[model samples]
Target: MTIKSGIICYIIGIASAIAQPNPDRPDLCQGAYFTEEEGAKALQTFASTYHDKASWEARASLIRKGIREGMQLPARPQFAPLKPIRHSLRTMDGYTVENVAFESLPGLFVTGNLYRPINATGKAAGILCPHGHAPNQDARFLEQAQQRCATLARMGAVVFVYDMLGYGDSKQCDHKISKALTLQALNGIRSLDFLTSLPEVDTTRIGVSGESGGGTQTFLLTALDSRVKVSVPVVMVSSYFFGGCVCESGMPIHKRPTHQASNVELAALAAPRPMLLISDGKDWTRHTPEVEFPYVQNIYGYYGAKDRVKNVHLPNEGHDYGPSKRAAAYRFLAEYLKLDLNRVLKDGKIDETPNKILTPTDLQVFTSEHPRPADAVVGDEAVLALLN
Candidate 1:
């Protein structure tokens, strides 16, 4: 009878097209406010029972996958830094944004945006901001990249934000699905070179952040490269498997990562550094943080930097980080990177925070440019230079 029940639960979960709540941890109660730990545990239960596309293994891999790989090794050859792609200066925040480009393979250039702050006495600490999937004009790379880049500048730090190749204004002509993901990963690594190359940048104190797809790249890049001193991956990490309707809405059935890179393992990459995951309580994909953070938190705890990894959840937001969450993420970045805000603000950094009205009503000014921002803006600051 008990075996039958487990089978029933799994079947029901599959039928629902969403994870069914774990009968074991009824206390963590789905769709309601849950303590981070409870959510983590409950999500684990759900991941094991559901068919989340290798969900259980992804969670397990987090704790064990990279034991042999060691830290700071060169990334997969596909994403290893190669020749410089192209570098240009584009306009953003009403000032020039340094655009860095690199070719992942032939006919493929991954571009990104770099923000240089004011009052740099020497090479300053830097941050790399990756964009989420929202038809990239670069504004949506991560809603807060621009604001944080500006803030970091004001605080006397250098920052770089680039659009992922396929998403923004890069001159790439093809959007074949698999190639895009590989290029996205390569762009993350090349971006590290871009930040370190800047004259006004510190290069050592670099950080990275992103949400959804961008957030996925943030941690992956941070893991592959040690230059990142801090990282905040909002809504990107997930139970390597499991299907949340809200989370899986647009996932291409064939294109997702095949192996699990658990939060535990990703945290291991940033073992001594600071890492944070901001999640939404109602989102279905919240399970990744749920199953991964507890174990990953322990890893950080073992390193005596337990406080470094924070799991912040918003009570009433969707998958993306809204204003309050973005603000919190910015604070986390500022505090960890130790940006010298007082100095930059006094003198003015990187062109007085470019403010042009963006459509979608709520889009704010963010400064990550991979290739360049999209040329056509429909509602505010609209331009068509790229197309012509």
Candidate 2:
């Protein structure tokens, strides 16, 4: 094609990005929407649009507005009572785990295990552990989830390891429902609410960390809500790709006729606040060390807080929240959240073997004896009605 035609095509692409997205065909930007060179060029273009702190804030505000509007997010609802239920406290090594359930919406329940340090004296830092897409109903029940939460708890953090919608015991709605992105985001906000409400938690030290789809949640929640003071999104931030799941990319947050932003920009919204980006060589985040991290670091530089943002790249690792990833996160959280890492530290290395993994049945919230509340909404349509 001629240079003139190339320019025309570029203009058309820009126009398409800003055009109103169709509801049915929701302007989805999923995995690897751009190649490495293309992603770098996109960041350069975004940089040109914002030179100084004020300009960057203006651009950031547009991105925030775009996310709120494009996601069709409702105004913050006055939270009805979360009506939290807790049972079966099991104390181990240096931490204790309990089954927990709370309502995010009036009838939409969020389920998980709450991990707290054993014999704590003062208010502890609160950490929200949102799980990624695991097979079957094993979202937060995965051993990695158990280990991290338990280990963090042992290190003196009040950790809440919760399920994603339709995962584990959060069965009120299907995970693939329309506006799932919106619901999960809301659930996350409410999870923060629940965490802060605990008398034992220190509200000022709130932090969040997750992998894959959960990593998507980590940044989204941190970006939209300033309540999250520290963020560690493992193996997910990427300029070349938006998230792949409906719960991650089903909404049109990345593209609107008036604005366009990438996941890297969304993650950068955590600027000035401490954040750790954990990336591996096997996924979309493979370019994070060279591409995504520097862009975000530049954004942090705008606030003169470049030291607060960090990137840990593992070229030999794949896309799961395995041991090495967890170790990196633990160190980051300990340093920033002021947790007693020495509790779980053994011979100069993080020791996770003390965490006892429970079976799915043991961690389940609603059993035959304690059934789902009769007032609970049953389907996606019912939950969406409440949100709308």
Candidate 3:
């Protein structure tokens, strides 16, 4: 049988044994679905089927539709007025941090920190920093997350580091709710809108980067939004590993009766645009240099823009967005987004010493003194009701 047919049978066998879909186990397929050699062969088969730009674009269009339908996202509502609240503007050595929050929908709030270069000129490049699934789903307060955003700000970019759904101060719904993917995607899109809306941001020089589950968000947003000129999805793109979180694979985006695709394909949809795939040896992306990277590079080749895509494989590292992974992403963003690299570079290494990492409470958008808005949706059922 063909690879797709065989995989379908495997999935069917698993589903039949369960009798009902497990809400806790949303991923129909994980990284172990194929061995290394099998994944390579599967990618080759998919790539060989698309011979021209038209064919690839046709496939991309279908994948995009599937993603929307699977997520149960309706026609996007009119742009909600971004009622932004900014506080605690602290100026550091080369950059400044401000706690900010804005509404993505009527009552759904997105919260996090915004970092900007102290000496930015006319229109600075904009970068969106989405954090992965940490222990508490904390957004920007993690040292690594703060370090990356602060370093980027020091390098002369306007970076907005926002919370994922039910993370940090966005506690309107549970993090693992069925619609997590839909809400997070919507929040990312709105974050882009909020970023570009800034008078200091250059709309054409926008980029998005995130690691792990956030990496899933990075590519998904880039696939749906053309405004993101560059993408760096770190440690989460795989041919067989359709993400493990409800926020990643909770929906049926990767499979349908007649159509099948993978995160490798979703990521490649950002082709012709600059992209950097950061993979590590211990994660699902360990095979990226062999399987995923080449598959995407092949798509970039179709547009005669092969050089725009790159992969930096850390064969010694694990899944987290550690220091070395951040360095690779830093160089790519500096090169593609036209940010000054020297500010964060010391002896050819990233120097995050200039960043002043704050405690989580410092970045909190709502506290006892500043209460969550009276209109904020509170329970899982209430939040899900908004989508319906």
Candidate 4:
């Protein structure tokens, strides 16, 4: 019943996340398995047995990876903080917008766009928009979210889109790796907080979905915040074992050390909650059924939501989400979180046809209202105060 066992999962480096039977003898990443039983246990161990700052401090590789490769933000004393501001858009349907700004870490910030759903007379479904590993570089963020938002807007759901820390306008003017990642998650969580705070948002109906690095953020944020009702982690999840010591060298999301909860355990967290895992039927990385499918399925089985868990395999598609692929993702969300299955389900959205997603536009989300320096460390205190 434990998620980790004093193991090598993210929270704890117990190393037991994988059953390292012959550690002294041999067997490294190649021999590891990421199952709910093992992963959940590992996570639990990290929380209970490995609550030492020294344990985290000793992992220099992890700390450096956290600081250099990704976005960071200052932490809020509250779980996370989200604010609502008014907005007007031409493309957006309902356009009940808000300007959400909060302190992620101490000196870091994560802020960006927020698009509300249409027909929101009362509390409505909410979502967090975390961008990809490299923002505009990823098609899903470049066009997918905007499309999805409009699609949902048409259906009358409240959606929020915020740039991931370091990806959009959310980058820190300071440099602190560990704190940055922590606040990045906090940023997403804060967005969730803001959603619940809204009189128009249905806190219980909130959902989160992300592609690539955003996919990782989806899982991590959902896992930490129980308030997130539904989630779809696309193009990334289980199969890490494959990318790690298998067919290819593990160039993981954010290039972290890769000992977090595997996709298997990640799915398990969605137990009763609805979860959608989208993968390119023809993925470039080792995210195929032979690699990660079984582990994720196993996690779902543990939840008794094996039926609730689903994956839309896009045939011959590389790493990106198109209208067709995105449709499948939306269906899963509408069915589980929105309860609008009858109205929101679109047939061609999840088309299995292999098509490239929209290329990102060269538009920047941050503006002078809250500007940042070119190369700020995530941990800088001054950098953290910009959004606040």
The best candidate by TM-score is 2
TM value for model 1? 0.62
Instruction: Give a tens-digit lDDT track for model 2, residues 127-230.
Output: 99997775455768877788899999999999998888889888888988878998899889999999999999999999999987899999999999999999
lDDT of 4 by residue, 41-78 (tens): 54454334232334433332353334233333333344
The runs of at least 3 residues in candidate 1 whose Cα sits more than 4 Å from the true structure, single-residue gaps closed, are 1-96, 104-107, 135-145, 171-176, 240-264, 285-291, 341-388
* lDDT-better candidate, 3 vs 4: 3
Error of 4 at 76 (Å): 8.6
User: lDDT: which candidate is best?
Assistant: 2
Task: Tell me how candidate 1 scores on lDDT.
Answer: 0.51
Ranking by TM-score: 2, 3, 4, 1
Count of steric clashes across candidates, in order: 32, 1, 0, 47
Q: What tens-digit string does per-residue lDDT give for candidate 1 at 1-388?
A: 1234323433432343344344553322122223446545544554454233244334435423342132212234443344553344444442334545554433344555555643356666777777654433444333355555555555556666666543454534433232344445555677777677766666667888876556766776776567888988876555442222222211232112333233335444576589887876545345544466665566566567778988887745555545556656666776787764344232432222343222322221223532223431222111111111
Models sorted by lDDT, best on top:
2, 3, 1, 4
- State TM-scores per candidate: 0.62, 0.92, 0.91, 0.64
Please identify model 4 stretches exceeding 4 Å from their true place: 1-91, 94-99, 135-141, 174-179, 241-261, 281-291, 339-388
Q: All models: lDDT? A: 0.51, 0.85, 0.83, 0.50
Error of 4 at 275 (Å): 1.2
Per residue, candidate 3 scores C-alpha lDDT tens digits across 303-359 of: 999999999999986667778889899999999999999988789878988788888
Which residue pairs in candidate 3 collide? none
Q: List the residue pairs that clash in candidate 2.
A: 18-257
How much does candidate 2 score in TM-score? 0.92
